[model samples]
Target: MSTATAIDADAAPWSPAQPVLEVRGLNVDYGAGRDAVRAVNEVTFTLRRGEVLGLAGESGSGKSTLAYAITRLLRAPGVITGGEVVFHQPSASGGPARTVDLLAADARELAGIRWVDLSMVFQSAMHALNPVARIEGQLTDVLKRHRPDMAPAERRARAIELLGMVGITPDRLSSYPHELSGGMRQRVMIAMALALEPSLVIMDEPTTALDVVTQREILDELMRLRERLGFAVIFITHDLSLLLELADTIAIMYAGQLVESAAAADLLAAPRHPYSLGLLNSFPALHGERVKMTGIPGSPPSLRAMPTGCKFHPRCPHAFERCSAEQPALLTPAGSRGKRTVACWLQTGDRVPPEPLGRPEGDRSQDLAVGGH
Candidate 1:
């Protein structure tokens, strides 16, 4: 893991010149009429060039829904009701300025942009790949789809090169999806995603199926590739520990909303939202000694009947009387230097201070040093 600190507010890493993708007030609804459920509720985030943003949450937190919505891959019963996914494409003049508004783009416009501008590596890499097709054909198919100008021979050469780029040998190109190991298949999916040199890539639970060692290796490889290619990435996962190691920034989702977002270091050091703090405490450290993990109790609320006020209040240990009546708006820290944002009544100064919750078994005073109470 890189010891490099996140870019400070003064650095402004997400400059207009380098903005690759921006999603604003994005909302996605599933089902219809009385059965409708709002999967994503006004979620907003941006992916800057060469940055990795980890979207972390438990199951049913709408992290996957946000990813599907951003890629325009949502299926029937799932509709993007509101918000805009803006994709910036570099202009011919070579200036940093680019075009925007991807959601409004027509099929022809999307055809020219998809894969070539934005690509995705979904969670189930094995299922995503064609079982009957050889690796070479699968990769070549992507190139042929977007770059039809390339001949068969040229496409084959490109496929070999891509396989090598992903740490697979050229000989493996003839192997079918069933022939490759899980990790290798995941890498192959990554290679296919990058085949068109898309400016942004969305990876949903990319390392979930792999073992610890393989997960570490694949994630390391991904970081190396990002350093080399300079494309933005949105990595969605439930593992906060992995996110701490791999992501530049971390976004915490609860219910159907983004509860908190901050630099990975800052978020780990001093989480603002109660849910984010609980999540951080839930994960056992990778490098540190193993401790008894106190997983967050209670399942996530159903999207159809989300709790009023703070959706997390139902399970939050710190929930007070006001928590059930008024929703908290997302707000920045009063004196924070960067883009640290959290949606919580505590941060909004709505109620009187409550007594501190008792610490967990492995709690160390120093562990809370970063994100002060």
Candidate 2:
């Protein structure tokens, strides 16, 4: 997987000005009627072409649910109740781009769009991979299904190339899922996801199971491939610190709703929402003084018995009267530096954000430890 011999066929020229995916007022629920518990609530965000949008939050924060909803991969009991997901497919010859309503797309239409236009790298490699099948079969299987035009030999060659792109030796293509290391299995999943060079890749905790060193290597390889292939990514993770490094734009989710979204640097320098601040302070800074880690107080609210007003207000230390009385909309802060938005009353008007909301001015580059799920 040297960059010099990389394949460029999947690198479709795209206009960065146009968004690749737009999720508007999306909602997902489990079961039906009153028994239906909301899993994703009015979540909205835009992912630009070739950009990395990171979705960070605590475990059971609807991160994976949101991903499944967007990709229409939700299973029984899970249903998309409302909202629209629009996918923009760029013109191959630089003409007007075509837009597809993902929510309205039938099975036939989705079959045409998936793999070629959009793909996903699921969270767990061991569970996602087929234990009985060989690595070569699994990798080539994707190509065989989607790229039917390719000959048998071509598919095999592509499978080998895909494995190599992620730093796996071609000789190991014959190995089964159980035969490979965790990192190797993860890399195989990545290769399978990229077999067709999708325009957008939804990675739901892609590196959760790997060691730190292997995680770095795989992430580096992924970034390199994204650069060469020109694809966008929705990176879902619990590690806010990791998103600070990988994502261009970061959206923080809490209790099934988006509490804040901003450029990665802006969030790092000055987190506007108390939940975001709590998340940052919860980790130990890699370079700062020995400060005590103050994790957020109380567990997340149960979907069946959610709190009134803001879902995070109970856990937010800076919660005020207004926070408990009215739900704060996700709106831009007054005099915000970038395209940052937070759902907190403190940042609504002239009121100053809490002192703890921001890192010290002297150490804005406070690298925090990556928390687990």
Candidate 3:
């Protein structure tokens, strides 16, 4: 699908003053024949400076696809059909800002901006790190590539300082990835991503593999570093409870499309979309008594053969005949906080009564309790 034709009818207009990273009408397709799949469909969101935007959804909900598309890191089978990722650069003096369209940038342009201006921390830190390389070598590699004029001694000193910044000892720099624990390796990845002090950092389930205590520690450290560095963060994960503690805003995605976007507190307090409410209810709260958590009834639809009209109609609790025949657009709801938007027929003035959207079979309460929903 072309980016121009994939946009939602009610998508908000783009403005450079408010957003540091803006994605407009993004579409990603895999394969070339008639069996091609559209992994991401007209997804749009803005990340402001010094803010954390949480992109939450299930495993195949296209959250990671959007992240990779922003960085131009999609593989051969996957191609960004259209859309623009505009990154605003502060102008020298007091002049107007400069915007770079990441999708249209050539390799040389990408080289000048990547890592130096944008960085990423993948989900599996162990797989990302080179097995044969020392921690110090991996850390210094970034500096050596971006800031080649620096002396070797200075680079080593910077690497040690970065390790300390992430709460790891400088001595650990000599160790290999296998020597450190899972949490430690994750910290090293964070340190490497932050070494150049980029304006934006995209993290894909950075703490998913760690234990609860370690996850909490890493998130706390990340918030502290964000405050110190003043960079925007795009945090992608399936855990909503953890995002409540770290994200300033939240965007919920379903069936490869963003169903809702709102301020974190507003979304937790009152979600406009039924899907968002179901996701919130699936979690076990720390303060509330143990209750049977409700998981959303159906699984995500296959991207290659999505349902007609609204892709979510088949699973939406508030869906009606109109929902099945006509797709709902992302529109601002009344009493919404800030720039809150929801893509659902109920939010678009539908009068249908709420009904059961089918619940997942089996008791998943234990799973919810342990997984933090």
List runs of model 2 lying over 4 Å from the truth. Answer: 1-13, 92-94, 358-373
For candidate 1, the clash count comes to 3
**Candidate 1 C-alpha lDDT tens digits along 1-373:** 1111111213223343567877899989998878889999998887787889999999889999888888777898899999988777654345444455767766666767778878899899899999999999999998888888999999999999888887899999999999999999999999999998878899999988799899988888888888988888999999887787788999999888999999887776666778887887775564545567666778899876788898999898888888899888777844456688888877764443332222222234545422122
Q: State every prediction's TM-score relative to the real structure.
A: 0.88, 0.92, 0.88
Candidate 1, which segments miss by more than 4 Å at Cα?
1-17, 92-97, 286-292, 350-365, 368-373
Query: How many residue pairs clash per model?
Result: 3, 0, 0
Candidate 1 displacement at residue 36 in angstroms: 1.4
Q: How accurate is candidate 1 locally (lDDT)?
A: 0.80
Which prediction has more favorable lDDT, 1 or 2?
2
Local accuracy by lDDT, each model: 0.80, 0.85, 0.80
Q: Pick the candidate with the highest TM-score.
A: 2
Per-residue accuracy of model 2 over 29-145 as CA lDDT, tens digit each: 999987999989999999988999999999999999999998889998999999989888766577666777788877777887787789998988999999999998898888888
Write candidate 3's Cα lDDT for 183-212 as tens digits.
999999999999888878999999987998
Residue 134 of candidate 3: its Cα lDDT?
98
